[model samples]
Target chain A: MTRPPPRILLVEDTPTQAEVAKALLRDMGLEIRHAETAGRALADALANPPDAILLDLELPDFGGFELMQKLRAEGVEAAIIVVTANASVNTAVEAMRQGAMDFIVKPYAKARLTVTLNNALEKRALTQELKTVKAQLSRDRFFGFIGASAAMQAVYRTIEGVAASRASVFITGESGTGKELAAEAVHKASPRAAKPFVALNCGAIPRDLLESEVFGHVKGAFTGATDNRVGAAKQADGGTLFLDEIGEMPLEMQVKLLRFVQTGSFQPVGASRPEKVDVRFVCATNRDPLAEVEAGRFREDLYYRLYVVPVELPPLRERGTDSVLIARALLATLSREEGKHFRGFSPEAERAIMAYAWPGNVRQLQNVVRNVVVLHDAEVVEPAMLPPMLLRAAIRPTAPHLTPMAAPVVAPVVAAAPVVAAPAMAEPAVAEPVPVQALPVPLPEPIFVPVPPSPPALALPPLPPPLPSVPVIEPLAVMEKRLILAALAETSQDVARAAALLEINPSTVYRKLQAWKTAGEIP
Target chain B: MHALRLQPLGLCHRLGVWVEPKVDRLASRWHHCHVTVLDPSIAGQLAEDLPRADFLLIINTFRDDLARLTQELTAAAATGDHHSFHRAAHSLAGAAAAVGALRLEASARLGMADEASTAPPPPGLSARIATEAQAALAALAALAQGPG
Candidate 1:
């Protein structure tokens, strides 16, 4: 059966411009669905999600950004290409950073639009392919590492291959991509597996003490050298010495390192003569060694010596759905540590994790899972339980296939302010809805809305006074004042309720109240 | 209400703007452009690198951009948004040059370099820009519709 041409939702306010764009895109054989207002667009997207959406930032009802946010929070996985006449570097950056696959400025060549659209579609196709691949992948856990992506498999193979060889192994990758674990894996697989595998972060140590930290210190090396300390090199003698962040090692230290790598000998700080140790060297750095050498920050000869057998670790973002595999593994570990029972991430949570760029890589992923497991508890880890940063990473329009009973149907309430529509429920909407829940505000008391019983299934929670769901950028003082005012309103001016809502001590609210009275900002 | 809302915002910028009559002069004199709407060299390279459909898509984009930018120039001028005008001009210059609309690009280059000493734009500058954009649009439309 032939698949229908990929559907594209073009959300633009201007009819003429939309017509022009629609005419232009029609030639590409793409079926274009045009929605001029944000509310309509939101409804259209939810009703029948397109394969890709070309969004205009400035919509008639509300900003298209708000609609995009809602779609993402609802876990829409369609590829989005944001189009804006208000083309500026800032707008382009924010759009892409918030999950737009691509951004095209106005007056763009039809060629540019097509290229962006095609690329987004291609990316979506690849992501879908990865999902299938992820399902088929086996051996999700390897050694101390957890990942089932082809990238991780290659890394495992590299570790196994390099382990038997005595040649110096150099690992490179961005921070949190598990370079240390790779080194340890290499050591564990090596002939010297029984021996201790000592590791040291070269960048973490102070410049003046790096030499002592790596090569050991004699009894009277410096003023603070209280006792003779065996350093990383001596400690890892007859085993593997993993020097992490090796690029940050001072130039003078590079000379010693080059000498050490050349000959398995090094003098301890303030020691009389050279000492030889059969230590296997495994160096890792989170920098471009060649670029460092070119910039004169790193010694050219030292780079060549250590760049011998390089094993580059891929960043978490490039590892496809390996994030899901790793997240499951991490959740299991974290839940055990926190004494929480989490079977795994809810599908939406998993989808969100998979879509995130993971700029901090595995370390960031670990921290997020640990934090979620520690503070929140549920049968399954949901998106709301994750950090605000992850919550903000609701881009990459994927399908929210699960017919979730709890997802608040995004019904626009007011004609004048379509942007402020939110869930008419007490329990939060999934996609972490908005930062509204993050504010220290208590839920309104039941007395505020006297509800006569209807069908139990038909009843919805009473809605609060609407707040704009769009993320706001404001100064700290303004935000604090707003929070206090909202807290007061939500709690009906009850001081205790307000304080409890704010998660602050009652006395702190009392002090704030008095200060506001003195300033006459509050009546 | 004799409306303040109806009146244009800010006045100092409107005091010293200049309109180059050259654009009107340029538009009226238009016939078959001595040079092609697009640079023949860039087009040749793009044709070799891109599919025919992709090439047409580009031409269509250039034509649409010209229309959009012309619209933006007018809106910016009416609102006394010189900053918006500057950005539009800057983008117009880049897009015009990329498609090889030499005359339009040259005028847009001037707009990019404009200090905007006058708030939004002087009287007629917006119209002048629109003329250049329209001429470019016609050239591009011809280019798009021309035999591949």
Candidate 2:
């Protein structure tokens, strides 16, 4: 629907002046209302406010400035333009100080009046638009999450839909993608909110102690079991038990966990009888649980039993602008904690924050903001205040090159074909020559250049020695294959021990070996 | 009061002229203006700035204010009251300035010079203002009756 024309209230005591102003306004296709006294103008304005007001300073009842004050006090937000015969600078200043948008000396030209009115109207429109955007931002904030992106909105909706249900919820996301927070939100939104919310990270505990941690052990059950302790299952009797890194739970533990889940009962260590308790299970994993099941590391029955409701959280990279919002919030909080005066990030800093893909998600953003707050003492966070690695990731065009046996890196490789065909340890292909000098820190050029890969010879040195002359760069894929074979030979072909020595996931090692075997690259 | 109010219209009728409604309509349609008439020396500036309809509106308002202030000035002059005469003359000056009546404005300003005096306005000052008012009304009526 089309909006009505702007209404203008003209407050002039003189009949001739009022008639002239009305004619000009009507000619401009505006709705005009005339009042001969300040009292009438105030009453009309308070009753039905117009878009703009043309006020004469000398009124029969009171001064126009006082009327302006009254209008402000009463919250009538019409744009007031002081139209007075007095052209004194003092009068103009006083009128503006009283909140008049503009001062027009009587008998103003048509062009001047038109331009001023249009400017006031445009300012009002911009203010209204800003108010609408703020309102949307506030609405987008749900539970503890601050994001308005479509992906996060869908996650919020899914959580709200499944919160009251009794079905188990399995959340899947990259590390630091707020899975535990999502589980807590589900518990808070459910009828079990008043009960305890127990959380245990399956991967963080030792395999021997994992079973006892889930279901309490009796006193003197074994070494380090001197006291009878209640476990997460009993602690979360009526509430949610959040098991983080469920994919990392050992196969033996998975059998007991599946039995407990099927019966809602568990046999504690050294306890003869079984103890029963009600629990709503919520599990999360950064790894792919289905892939773990296919590899026979996860029980397929337990996976089906717990994967009833799936909540896949979008990574911080996919959540546009949310990184900025989270950074600002973290800055405010971290500054308060550190007794700093930082209010927000500079535009360049915000741009960098938005451009970089946060592989570690909100956790990484929190650490980056905390690092700035603790190190810098300023009111605004500049790009120089950010961590060097974040700055490089943000400014660098392509993703960081990942070694085949190295742990997974979440950077987006723009040149997908080249990344696949090129050697694994090759330097990332520069789409264009970036001006590294523009960066605050002058980094060495060798950091961007390719270094020689470790040799594939079985007699591998502990570390590659610095070359006396320019060393020849080797293919990264060949070096990676040799390193794996060397590690396997040293560990007597034990993939798990080799993976441990390499500090990468055993599943990663297994997958690589299977790929090599299928291609007949290795026997 | 009635005779004073009818004076300008009667003068227009006696001159064998009447303001044409088409001229008022045409002027209203043609001109949408806002003018400042502060300088008394800018004679006929109001005529050039305003359409005939707007000029007539100001003229009518000036005529009414002139009749009321004229009565007040006559009473103050007869009663030897300088304060009332000064007040009436100040308002009459403003009214004259609204329509750019230079001669009437000058006469009213002269009457305002007795603001601090205990005695009444100067002799013949009221007559001077009355004469200027009559001449101004006649001129405004003639302007209104001109061709569109």
Candidate 3:
């Protein structure tokens, strides 16, 4: 269960808008995949459905509505977040009707993205948890987790042990260790399970807005603060607050956070009165907090405050043949997704999965399985079909001690009946992972039906570019001209009324018009 | 989240788009903007464009616009389009002054004079203007680099 961040598909045409979004969400703990056109976006989504999609309506190949419709039909379940310059209600209503999670306009602040993405990530986490819980086999698993190895067994024990307590739980693991999943497990096992579970990755948001994100901001708090919205801290009141990558938080904000943690009160940015919230804190980070403290990057007092009950997650390489187990699980799920029957992996492929150091953990395994399901039609996945890294890996024997625990789960899954594909269905319960060598039953036939090629493009008017530069005033002069002309025409050439509407002197307007005429700029 | 930003040398802390505020006395009388590097209004507008806009980007944009307008002014003078020359030169003058380049501003204003009062500008004017703009840009680069 190497915890991969939530995967997000970003469909945007303009580089600046994409760049802006990346900067804002870089610290939010989501893995973002950018697609400049609808074709690429569809390809990516079809290959591996993301947890969320930040879609730009105006695309080169198709409209967002068409893409969303296609994705829904194909069982791609990622939440669609509509991002456009025009935040019109009609667009909002249409996008929502087409299944958008939320709508946002351009020139958005760092705080704005934080709120939107946090909600999307939460929905995804909850959905995954729900699916995992509903599946009969998953009943034995903790949340949406599956691992019977000593490492995962220890994690389950820790989450169960701490479930009833109100103590701050700090979970630490390398990049793919399922830290967020573990956090969700903690929330579900706790008394606050019925309440909300709000989480934020301290590393993924802009520093200026991080305070506003955690503590919330008032209207006009900063340049782009157009409305007042509650932050995660307040939103998670009477619930649990999980702060991932707590190590990445700025030191100054750490001081403020320490204060809030000590006394359950905080003031939103630009707010006069402080707020009090009753919430439990569950924080996590990959780096050694003690090292961070020595480096002077992390606050020592804050570390001690948050590191009460630390849960260390194991990396994939150390998890023995769990890669094979996870890969089979992924194959079962993704094969059904692609409607391809990849009954199982070849002996060499199994050996490679067992031997390769899966630096990307379960997420990478999922992708590799996806790669095979997408490109090849064979029932058995050969090592050559695996990623080059897996093929080039030194084939090490599976650790003997870890082999026995996975033996019992392999037979049940293969012997069991094939599961049908349903869009809103819960995840099939994760069986005890069956080691590759322990697999006893013969798998079903390889179905060679490849996915039909995409249909003709659904053309929609492309959105205008975000950065529109004018040769003269660039974008500004045009706006100024429009304002002036609108005022002039509205007043029927009454300079006084037009100037009053514009809050400018009539003489100034007259002078500008005369200058424009002199320069032959206006008729 | 506030702790995660990669700030540059204790300067304009932003989304890795680090830009330090002015270090020299450019906003004073000795320098046209000895109190600030660029006109406060324009600087504010730039910041508005990117509330957390990096100072490095502003410097880069200013440098690019200065070089481009210098070329435009030269081309207008070459074609004997005095009005175009005046427009380009005036535009350059305003932009240069806004960014605190006194020498470049003065040079650009030379092209702003009416054609009726003076002969068309000579070819070397462009070269001189270019040189001044280059020097001004170099100064800004130094300001960005700081003592280090």
Interface DockQ of each model: 0.02, 0.11, 0.01
DockQ class, candidate 3: incorrect
Question: Looking at candidate 2, what TM-score does chain B attain?
Answer: 0.66
Task: Tell the DockQ for candidate 1.
Answer: 0.02
Model 2 regions lying over 4 Å from their true place: A1-138, A393-523, B1-148
TM-score of each: 0.42, 0.43, 0.39
Model 1 ranges with Cα > 4 A deviation: A1-137, A399-523, B1-148
Please give, for residues A1-523, the per-residue lDDT of candidate 1 as tens digits.
Answer: 4878988899876543465466557668888898978898888989988889989886646887788899898878899889875567899888987899989876455578788899999898899789865654555776788887888888887788789888888899988999999999989999999998999998999999999988898888889888988888888888999999988999999999899888989999989988898989999998988999999999998888777789999988778788888999889988888899988987768867876678788898999999888888887988767653343233212322212223322222111212222365565454432322122222221112122343322111112344433334455466566666776776577666566444456677788779988999999
Candidate 2, A94-174: lDDT as tens digits: 999999999887655445677888888778778768987566544567788888887888888788889898899999998
- The best candidate in terms of DockQ: 2
Q: Report the TM-score measured on chain A for model 2.
A: 0.53
iRMS per model in Å: 7.9, 3.8, 9.3
Tens digits of lDDT, candidate 3, A1-523:
3898888999976554565566557667779999989889999999988999999887757888899999898899898899875457899999999998998775455667679978987887898888864553323356877665667777788888898899999999888788999899999999999999999999999988899999999999999999997999999998899999998898899999999899999999999999999999999998888899999999888888888899998877776666777888888888899999789988767877876667777777778889899998878888657764453242212322111121111111122424323223233322342332232222221111112253312111111111111111325456566667765775577677566445456788898799889999888
Q: Over all chains combined, what TM-score does candidate 1 have?
A: 0.42
Q: Rate the local accuracy (lDDT) of all candidates.
A: 0.70, 0.73, 0.68
The digit string of per-residue lDDT tens for model 1 on B78-103 reads 88887778767766765665555665
Better of 2 and 3 by DockQ: 2
